[model samples]
Target: MKGRGFIFAFLPLLLTTCIDPFDIGDVVNGQPRLVVDGLLTNQPQAHEVRISYSSPTLNTFDREVVSGADVFIEDENGSQVSLIEDTEREGVYLTPSNFAGTVGVTYTLRVRTAENVSYRSLPEMMRPVAEIDSIYAELDSRQSLSSLGTLLNNWGMQFYVSTGTGTPESNFYQWKWEETYQFTAPLAREDQIIQPICYQSGRQFNQLLIGSSQDFSQDRIGRQPITFVSKNTYKLQQRYSLLVKQLSLSERAFNFWSDVEVQRDTDGSLFDPPPSQIIGNMVRDDDPEDIVLGYFQVSAVTEQRFFITRAEVPASPGGPIGGFSSCVESSEPPADGNNGESSGGPDDGPPDFCYDCTLIQGTTTERPSFW
Candidate 1:
């Protein structure tokens, strides 16, 4: 899901439908419309709300962060939790790690932009969700014609997940995942000592997964595909791991995300529906007539993770795809006896964090506590 991009793409259309040519001045002089994407869960963790602007008038649709905005969430009990701006992440406001809402308790989102314009979310109730019974990787074949259009080769692994019986009243569900893997550098330092394998991790940024038991006869869901990872890709070069978080959505939130998922799948297809705007849960309190985009959703999340070793994914005929067959080659030829490359960070450091421990295209050397 190209979250920001879709808002940018459909906004101009939304504006065209709501704005009148006779009132061109309103479109030109009116305050910019705000966009919000927020989610809350029963899990005790730092939650976030992202505030941005829709500049539909711009030549290119770009999200304008609304910084210096006052943001917070209030519970039915009247206790208010303040959210502080995450400076590193523009437009993001984070709640304290101790903050956690309870199931059945309704929460409201409140925001006041630097300009004094205020916004609020319709009260959303937190709901409980079924825990994932299990999550695992299936080394399914991902074959396609090669560049020469002559042969088809094995590609990647498709992940499958399952959940226990869900509550009848709270059957709607959505998924979010983070992926981590280990990779060794192709070339090392002048010292010529082999570098240890380093681990890197990253969260899936945009592929939205939403489902429900509304149409199913059973209360549980099983063997549903969650995602796929190409074999021999950097992520599959060594060991691989995945953590999936399942969140239970309210009816309103489900409908909103369902629309987004459908539109995403049908994008560019011949049967795709005409472009349309997705009206989210946020709106202009200053002016009811303003057209706003995006959603502020609340859910109860249950998460689980699984590890897939490099060997677990069957090695293809070409071995692990691209190079790495002989990383020892070095900048020049190794001194004959050492056919492999001798590489380490030019400077000294653990093989995991040669330069930085925190960043490696989402990989980190600090092993996950669960790992």
Candidate 2:
């Protein structure tokens, strides 16, 4: 997954509601606000909490990292575990590898900054998440505005998830996904001993994906559309693997993310509702009135992996997309047919990736274990 730059985005939402006059200059020169983003799940892994201060929306500086802070999580049973800060990542703190949140156990996150300003989160209980019964994809199309101000039909794949009902008390859910796809270079050949196959992987960022079974009469979610991949992109060019993680959220957590989604989806139209102050669960012990900016989440997570091949998706009506259109070969091969560089001259040759596939970004020749 990408870095949570969303923390920075949350700043404007808070500033607009908390500050007077709504002046841009005031925010540009205002004090940095503390942000706490942490999550604990049922999976036994080294969970992490990210601590940073929000950078001014108009500032050129990066997000402010609150390093050398003391961070920990305590359970309702009075057991506590200290999190170790990552030396390389500054403000990020990680729990022990064996540490995992158990269902029904309430957990609270605490932080003490280097400045001695302490903050604590309201206790959040880990709730049980439903297992994904199945994952499927189907051909779909969406109309989008073109640069010429005309509607253009963009064809793509829509991925859906069907899951059994969760515990009655835990029906709110959020879904996150990471995708890995396999692609081959256009000019690769076995006889010439070139590594053609490669893989690229990434996760959806910036977008909030959440659903509630309470919205439905059945109290169960079926075929919920978690994400969509447009056929115009390279992701569907070859074999693709998507791993979807489902997390259970409390009603409060669900409402919090829903508000975030509302703010994110607003296109800055006159009819859009003004962004409101999103009060997180954290409160500063040193100053009760300070507004902390992020959420500390506790959830029971379940996951499922789905795979698809190029042949599975029908061809786009507009024609083949995602091909290496830029990888054009010269009429004549290299002088010795070995350098893989243009005959014009090694220094004057086209991009390195035109001849070798591995040089492409986000691609690796090594096959994934799951693949």
Candidate 3:
């Protein structure tokens, strides 16, 4: 019994070790790396380049903004445009509102930071992407571990896109998407004290989605999987909208994105390749040996938006999804439910968010134009 108890006591620690194999603390060590992400596309709009330092190792999601940088985008023909720092958003520099990239024209990005460290990217030609054919989704099931550590199957939708036939010059591609969905409260009041319905928006980022047609017999992209939405959440509870943007990438840019994808997907296991920084095209002006993180991409862009209504998905065995299981009313009503007043009143409701949807992050009472 004593030996069995000891083994059980250590089992949780062992499980935790297996679940998180990488020791990020030892690898990141709070060292700040310069990260620059810049893009110029064929669409006529205000282009942007973000300059910042990677968050301290311990806080990888938080960025240290690099401000007061002299940023510019120039073409091979000697034409140049200075990017002005957005006073509203630090570390972000923007081009003129009417500026746009021309297909077949080579572009380069240059930046000089407040510290006077200069960096530049190798010029890359903008390639034109074919128009997207169609965007669709399929009902599917995904396996996830429940809080009890048991594997559970969750229903969801897997999204795919078919793009134009690929030619040797147009084989490399990249995609990015954002989603907005409508959800409502479980309970409704006759009088509209607050908005019972709300819309939430989010983007799928940090995950590189790219494709190549060179290896296939038919030089076209068909049913290329772009993203997925699980019914485990309120996203698929009502109407959902997804906007996908397709970009044509140069071979060099494709290769850089491939390296980034590999590094992002890598797990520090014995069988996995050792982790290393995936270098981009940017190089330090004075010190070639110094590393600069992130990429500068110039591409032609095409985009489409698709919507999914709850009616399309199969009915859940447990009936319609409630706003949130935790959003239940308290046994005792508060005084003034308006603005979470706890004074005892017949209208008072428990769980503040159930009374007002805006309390939730990324939620808005205003209906989106697309909706």
Q: Using lDDT as the measure, which candidate wins?
A: 2
Query: lDDT tens digits, residues 1-371, model 3?
Result: 11000000111000001111111111234566677778889898888887777655445455578899999998999899999999898888999999999999999999999889899998989987889999999877778798999998766788988886655434788777888898765555567676568888877543557787766655577877777776656777789999999888887878765654555556678999886666678889999987677678898999999999989877664345333544454523211121222333335444555556566565788899888
Per-candidate clashes come to 8, 0, 4
Give residue 206's error in model 3 in angstroms: 2.8
The per-residue C-alpha lDDT of model 3 at residue 312 equals: 86
List candidate 1 stretches off by more than 4 Å.
Answer: 1-32, 58-61, 88-90, 143-145, 149-151, 166-170, 183-195, 265-273, 316-365
Candidate 1 residue lDDT tens string, 226-277: 7788764556766788899888878787877666555544557677786455
Better lDDT candidate (2, 3): 2
Per-residue lDDT of candidate 2, residues 174-237 (tens digit): 7778888887655644466755787878876544567776644554677778677877666777
Residue 196 lDDT in candidate 3? 65
Model 3: residues with Cα > 4 Å off, grouped in runs: 1-33, 53-64, 114-117, 166-170, 190-195, 270-272, 316-323, 328-352, 355-359
lDDT score of residue 260 within candidate 2: 64
Which parts of model 2 have CA positions greater than 4 angstroms off? 1-31, 56-62, 145-149, 166-170, 188-191, 266-273, 316-318, 328-355
Q: Residue 242 of candidate 2: its Cα lDDT? A: 94
Task: Supply candidate 2's per-residue lDDT for 336.
Answer: 11
In order, what lDDT does every prediction score? 0.64, 0.71, 0.70
TM-score of each: 0.74, 0.81, 0.78
- The stretch of ten residues in a row with the least summed lDDT in candidate 1 is 17-26
